[model samples]
Target chain A: MTTTAHNPAVESHGHEHGHAEHHGPRGILNWLTSTDHKVIGLSYTITSVLMLVIGGALAEVIRGQLANPNGHLVTMAQYNELFTMHGSIMIYLFAGPFAFGALANIIVPIQIGAPDMAFPRLNALSYWLYLSGAITMLLGFFVTGGAANFGWVGYAPLSDAVYAPGAGADLWIGGLLLTGFSAIFTGVNICATVFYLRAPGLTLFRMPIFTWNLLVVSILILLAFPILTAGLVMLYADRHLGTHIYSVAGGGVPVLWQHIFWFWGHPEVYILALPFFGMVTEIIPVFSRKPVFGYKGMVFATLTIAALSLGVWAHHMFTTGVVLLPFFSIMSLLIAVPTGIKLFNWIGSMWRGQIWFSTAMLFAIGFVVTFLIGGLTGIYLASPPLDFFTHDTYFVVAHFHSVVMALVLGGMAGLYYWGPKITGYMLNERIGKVQFWLAFIGTQVFTIPQYIVGLNGMPRRMAVYPNDPEWQTLNTWSSVGAIMIGISTLLFVVNIVASWKKHPAGDNPWDGHTLEWFTTSPPPHHNFFRLPQIRSERPTWDHNHPEAKALAHGKEDH
Target chain B: MRIESKILLWLGIFFGLMCAVYWTWSLENAGGVMMFFAMGLCFLPGLYYFWWSRRMGYRPEDDPNATQETGAGYIDAFPGSSIFPFTLGSGAFFVVLSMVFGSWLLIPGLGLVIWAALGGIAEGRRGGDK
Candidate 1:
């Protein structure tokens, strides 16, 4: 509640000098060898953004090829590799690590009042493993057969040794295996930190929403990632050891790959999604000037969603006809209930509250609107009949793009929201708004036509389409949208560089409600100088409004 | 804890009944049954917390004005510079690379992994290093 500009505690501490004196290892060596959580988090974030640029360039290639029917932009094999590496890079290298590795590492321990992770060495190992994995995966581009072209899921028989027959596929499996290990290490660290490192007065129900979400994410990573790792191990065996796990000619069932992959795959969506949900949960309340509405409902909803996520894996396998139709259908539909509850809670938090339309808030609201469309279409695809028609089509492509757009936009919101704290400078708001609008509009413009083409019986993952004039027009519009997205990303870079030292953002730029805001902007080596007395979930709120009402005992239970 | 457990207990009962209905209609309804079971298991944490809280009485987290000592203290000791992370990363890369190149690379890969893992664990015990 105490403003950063006026806080005597911040002035007295002189954290920058004190921090450097205590925490040794200066310069680039510090970055490579340091065990500090903040340094590791920044490294993860920087790497992810760079990966995003690489993935986006591949996307531009895909769009350029699709601009015209029977276009000669790329061969069929090149197209396959482009899409495969694009999805793989974005999911494995960017979104997942950006959320869990970068944001959670920096934010969770601070929120819980822990100075560093439970296992700092393991944390550093996780980052190094991730980087090594990314390099190995990208190494495929320079190889003989190019990158693995079996799509991101790497569905079997197609991904088998007979079909793939190269070191590229091997590299894909090995890269993912290493990243899987990285995720497992980070997941263990997060779970241990949450359980053991919480501050005084920070109980289970009283923890911040972002911390709660990360806890569930850690659990999901711990339980779900090993399945993919095991599956990938089998895939490697089939490719190199001449095993018959997925090869149909060798008396193996290819659909078994689908089952194993989607089991991990479905939960993987939530791995990327839940953190954004947490970001929006944090952003909405701060901008709305309200405590999160229906706090217990939000928690229960998040838990239920994670549980249901495990059961709904077969929804992706619905069109394969090997899965149980009614069973997967019912479970998938049921997931909508908990997800809808979260949407309602977000709106309820904003209802009749004083609203500020900061760029971060705009993106959070954008996430809500965008993700709703994705969730609804997901339900539509949950139906066995609809899925059978739209299977492997542009509709499915549009659906996932919408969902991923939500995650990416929400992540941007968090980046901007926490920019002041992370960098000690406020981002230029005018440029930020321009970037957000371009991204929002461009995403809609790009994906809406894909749905139209999908309904008109166009398949996905094709280098060239039939020479229909209508298809060309739609593809052209979509390509324009892709260019817009690219420009918007450039604007983000401009904003970062443009505002590097223009404005010094003091500690609590947004009057934030969480514990991280209580510390200085770009917090010291040890995060907090003196801790606030935490009573409830909103410790800063309690600090600010001491006499608003007698502290409501177990109000979070409501 | 008591309040949340009681709420989830009833919610679990409600979902359990729904699972029964779905199970009766289709005996092959594994997804519905499993989903409901998972939902029911979500209540276990709340139940455990409720029992733990009742037995232990109030902790520092439950009281607003608890003293600083009641809180979990400052961070435990952090490790200084070590080559374990780099060595472990190198070991993993080579192991993966061996899958492509040949079995000969596996020897050094496995050795580095073993050395790094052992060294990382031992590095923590050297007192006053950091």
Candidate 2:
């Protein structure tokens, strides 16, 4: 328990303590042990990039096998491991850390005008723990029994030691347990920071939409992940100690795992998507040169999405033969309202403004287009009968990939747009546009036909499809598209590295309105030279000029 | 800054020590429910010191103004060292001792004691710094 520390510039009658800035170590040695929020953020970004490449390579190998029906490039064991690692690495290591964790570490403090994350050293600890978990799980690949093949879900008796009989399952559970702890610790840190660390005059209502979205996300992680920890611990007990948490013969219920996993898993979708919502909110306002449409409404909608996310886990469990469909259906439909609100907000934010088709904006627009199709199809999958048809089919695969691709692509857009500010250098826009188009076209070429293939009754996770004439053309096209997508991803890496040092970017390259833009590009050890006065959500807007301020604030009375 | 924080600090230490003892006792007894309960107990003193510190008028550890962007207190609370010391050390200590000593309850029981002692000592020191 500590006193609420007030910024030096703000002279409240509150008591203040003189803090000695502790500089522990120096150089790369310092970075290795460094607790700086920015350094930790860089660590997250670098780790995520490496994981993305690893996961993408796995995807390529799997797609190569499935390129043609019954293509014998890999054994079933190899395919199962590939898909499992692909899903786990992409979701946990790539999307989770890179998108929210990295961005939040870098930007959230800046957005709120705080100097750094509330817990910088703990921030470093969370990243290390996450890396450890990810590495341990990947190491299972080289083990004697191979990796866990019960899918990333690591479902019951199939994952049981008796049925699976391997050290792989133990490793899987252990890795996830460690990862779950990291997520929770990071959530705790973020929540505390957001609650207690806002600069003077920066009220909750005045916080940026991205910060608001992350606030809801942090809460969701806190509420959802602890249960996942509990569930993983139980599963580990069953695997190693002969406990019967999921064993029916031992009086344990197998369906219990599904309930616990999806409870966390469903919110995990929002955990992934909500930050994209935040980035979209940020991008839309900047490109349009307009205040975000319905800022308060967007905040409310984000919170609603996080809240309703908890009750809809059963939607994924519908085909499991034991789900409360009525409850799940109601919950699922309820989620649509908030999601639809965000959709309208994005569209409304872009309405009638001078739309700049920057590579960043292209991905934002791409997200909206792809997410719509994905959302509509998601509604179909929410239904019990429809899900039964789409269950295990390429249709389900198509719908999910669409949603996830839109989400991750939006994240990529945010990353590139903000990377300059974070690094104090501009990306190679020429190569950026190339990479964007390649990814945009590659996604469509690769995934759009997945819906058709799924409808034609192609089961997912199969290394080889039987010689069904209907699935051939689309499957071949999808595989080719995947290769293109992989190439584009590589170009994105090249573009980032090539321009890392040479390109120059100013503090406000996009002329953004948020508080983050008020500081130096890449900022300093302490984010701001002197903490600026915060009146509204957009502090930089006020500091930039009084005339621009009047334009934004003018609508207050109107 | 105040006498109350010092008292609360020692109070935190006392409860922390009690928690450590209770946890170790539970581990040596090999009671699964008790072991779980002990883990929960470990969170109490850290929380109490945190609460008491705030009440006693110390700015929060994470408050940028209080920490001065140097992150001194953050590391003290949650150290990045491998938690396997708690997990594996305790798990192994219990399993091995039970096997060698032919005492089914001895290893897990002592394992719990070790976990409680270590966790309590670390957390207690974090609060004692101020």
Point to the candidate with the largest DockQ.
Answer: 1
Question: Can you tell me the CAPRI class of model 2?
Answer: incorrect
Say which candidate scores most in TM-score.
1
- The Cα error of candidate 2 at residue B40, in Å, is 16
Give all candidates' CA lDDT scores. 0.81, 0.71
TM-score of chain A of each: 0.95, 0.95
In model 1 chain A, the worst 10-residue window by lDDT is A1-10
Measured against the true two-chain complex, the DockQ scores of the candidates, in the order shown, are 0.28, 0.05
Q: Model 2, residue A451: what's the lDDT? A: 88
The best candidate in terms of lDDT: 1
Tens digit of lDDT per residue, candidate 2, span B30-69?
1223223323432443355457657755443323223223
Worst 10 residues of 2 chain A by lDDT: A11-20
